[model samples]
Target: MTPEDLQTALARALTLAESGLVAPGAADGPIDVVAPRRPENGDWSTTAALRAAAHPSGRKALAEHICDHLLTLPEVAAADTADPGFVNISLTPTARARAAIDAACALQPPRGPWSNAGSGPWSDAAVDPNVIGALQLRHAAACRERRRARAAGITTDEADSSTLDHPSEARLLNALAALPGAVDRSRRLRRAAPLVTGLSDVADAVEEWLSRCAVTPTIDEDITARHSARLVLVRAAIIVLAAGLRQLGAAAPERI
Candidate 1:
């Protein structure tokens, strides 16, 4: 199904819940459906009815009732009603992947960064560059120290090296340090979009690249590099989308 179709179905489901057609408290909270971090959980599962069933009736009956209503939707491939009223809805993998891609593509460019330069909702004026610089230097030193310790046959904590000491982390820090000039360059690029249509096309190209990467079963080093490059664009898109949604007083779901 398309993103709009899935959204409409979700809206109808919410309306049904609001009208007491579905169990009470079933549509509440940040996420009613508990999406699994790993793909193995069959896309999305929810214990909303199970949690709501604690009222007059028990969970089992409530779960069965909710499942009955959900089974009417074509997008739902299968609805497994568990004991204590848990309804697990599984969608077709192809459909779910398409929905994800569509959502990513719907994102608009961020409100000009300068719009948030001063004070507004969600301001970042308190950020201290000196403190950030100090932290980066200390983190770089710690990484060097960890490498030395490892070379000396010490059993250093792997977590620190894996995260803070990673080469990518250092590169990211360097990038942030040089972001002011980069922002200026990006603004210039935005203005020159007509003249640089080929480069402008790269941003539009990101969504398709992300979709391809998402469906790949296994990625080798070369493939990984290409995916990583595309992901940088994808992340920028996410930040822009999140910022826009926040401005519109809507909550963007956290990325998995």
Candidate 2:
């Protein structure tokens, strides 16, 4: 589901909880959904429970109550409360898959509030240069890997016998899942989008994908489609990164 979708769902769920819990109007305050740093922590998390716990019912009961209400939503497959208050949300598998594919197809950056010339951390012009340099190095490494595979006389047209299975590929998906939060934060914080957090996530994921994958468009068609997917994801990364830089008054160079 999209950010707006999830946000709306959470709001509705909170509304459902208002009359039943210690929170008379628990849904009155602002709500936030977070992308966990750990992949297994769940697709997203919310502080709604903690927010409501400040009333009187306390954290545990509020967490459970909110989670129960959240579970009633169609988009959410599972909702569970972690200790003290955070409510972790897992979207239905189909929802997660659709979100990933949608992100890949769109591959566009959402507009951010801050610009490079603004008085913010991302105002520096050098960040993109560093990012571009790293991207160049990665591209060169990919070319070299392909060259070696070719020198050993590996055939381009052959298909892999194995199904899709790669750690880096899995990591890439996790990286994509984190992008919306990053974009929203960029806008909300009025900071650069390609800052250390989101941009680094994309870059590190891309770097890992490069090191782990063994296919090349210059030679072989990626039988598992993993390589193509990685390329798509990385392209989205660069597009968003560029948008962030440009908004921040930094020029995104065509070449590093």
Candidate 3:
């Protein structure tokens, strides 16, 4: 699931958990569900409960209650309390696969998520010839190349994230899932810098995955479900990056 999805779920859980303690509007702030810096922490974590708690003494209890509600979600596997008021969540592999496919499909024909139309979030911003802009263009080109390859049937099998066992695959999926939320957050704040940084993180994760896994194996026998799943992730990343770059008033050229 995307971070925004998780945030919405978390907010609902928090509201239910905070029933009598917090007033109706007290817990109406943005709920931030971010990828933990440390891998061992979990797929995503949030400290919104801490801020929502009426008193410091009840933070732990509120966190546990919210986690209890979060665990009810089918997409969620585990929701554990950490640091008294923080909740670390782990999504099911199937949910991850579904999320990646949803992202990829959202960019396909008809009306896609990323629009090249005039007057958008970044319409007022200037796209100068700076390093960040250059990097965004390069990544956009790479995404286009990858999407072209995917459309050519380099990955024919359906995406099955359950087959994804490599650490790189996990990291890539996690990064992909977080991109939409980051873009939304950036748009809400009316700033392109955070989205740019988030794109860099996704790029770094892609680089790491490429360094360790083969998206298109040379030998036919070596092609596996893991590779196909990775391709889905690549496609997802492509659309997300394209959407974010478009919002920044940048061009994702068909070729570099």
Candidate 4:
């Protein structure tokens, strides 16, 4: 799924939770996502509720507050909380597939049929025997490379690149409001620890999603045009992530 889509949904839920808090400002910040360490749990987990535990409204109250709102988002199949208040989110299978398309659109609008060509969503079918194997490695590598490029701000079609955003990792941004200046090392490090941890965690969650939906590519494989478009959608997710990290001062990692 386009992680940002999930992040946007979470952000709205957070907004709802914050509205009822004693200090709405305290609830403001990036909402980190991670693959659940325990398989039995939801697909993505965030500690927004836990972070807001210190709020005047109380931890359980704040936690449940966010949980209630998260449940309202269609993209979120399920929302649950852990002790001390962590909200775990599960995406419906359909939502997961749609997210892949959204990710593709964020990179560049779907071309071929999904665009101004023939029909909508999809108008054809394609098949391949190697639909679920090492091919995923190539997709992963390509995604990582594009991610690197975006991180460096290397410049793609401006319109295409501009469509991607990493609001989930907004905490990583060293915005003027967060610190005294860019050179304030000690303070920056202090405030940034969570952001770094959050990035790593969210990457894992996104990876898990990608791993689940691996398929054929557009160039080397003999897949149908419809499947090719699906790959494009998957590829866009890499750009989405890279663009976001760049905002946080990522040096454009040479490799994931």
Which lDDT values do the candidates have, in the order given?
A: 0.39, 0.57, 0.69, 0.45
Model 4 stretches astray by more than 4 angstroms: 18-22, 108-137, 140-256
What are the runs in model 1 whose C-alpha is more than 4 Å off? 1-31, 54-57, 110-120, 123-256
Q: Write the per-residue lDDT of candidate 1 for residues 105-135, one digit (tens) a residue.
A: 4433333454443222322233243433333
User: Model 3, stretches more than 4 Å misplaced?
Assistant: 18-24, 107-110, 118-154, 186-190, 218-220, 249-256
TM-score, predicted candidate 3 vs. hidden true structure:
0.79
lDDT of each residue in 8-105, candidate 3, tens digit only: 88778767764565435655787777778887777888987787887888788888888888888998888999887888988888776677667656
Highest lDDT against the true fold, candidate? 3
Q: Which candidate, 1 or 3, has the higher lDDT?
A: 3
In model 1, the Cα lDDT at residue 137 comes to 36
TM-score versus the correct structure, for each prediction: 0.38, 0.62, 0.79, 0.44
Model 4 residue 82 CA deviation in Å: 0.8
**Colliding residue pairs in candidate 3:** none
lDDT of 4 by residue, 1-256 (tens): 3344455666666566645452455445666766566655756677766665556347677767777887777766678877767777766544554554443343232431112222111122321223212223333554764454345343323223112223221211111112112113322353433333333433444454444433343345443433333334435444434432432333333343
Residues 1-256, model 2: lDDT tens digits? 7555666777776676545454666676778876666667777788877776546447777778777877777767788888768888777644554554455444443323332234254433445557655644544444455455455445524432122235455455545555656766665665564344655665576678766675444543533344334344444445544544444445545443
Clashes of each: 1, 4, 0, 1
Q: How accurate is candidate 1 locally (lDDT)?
A: 0.39
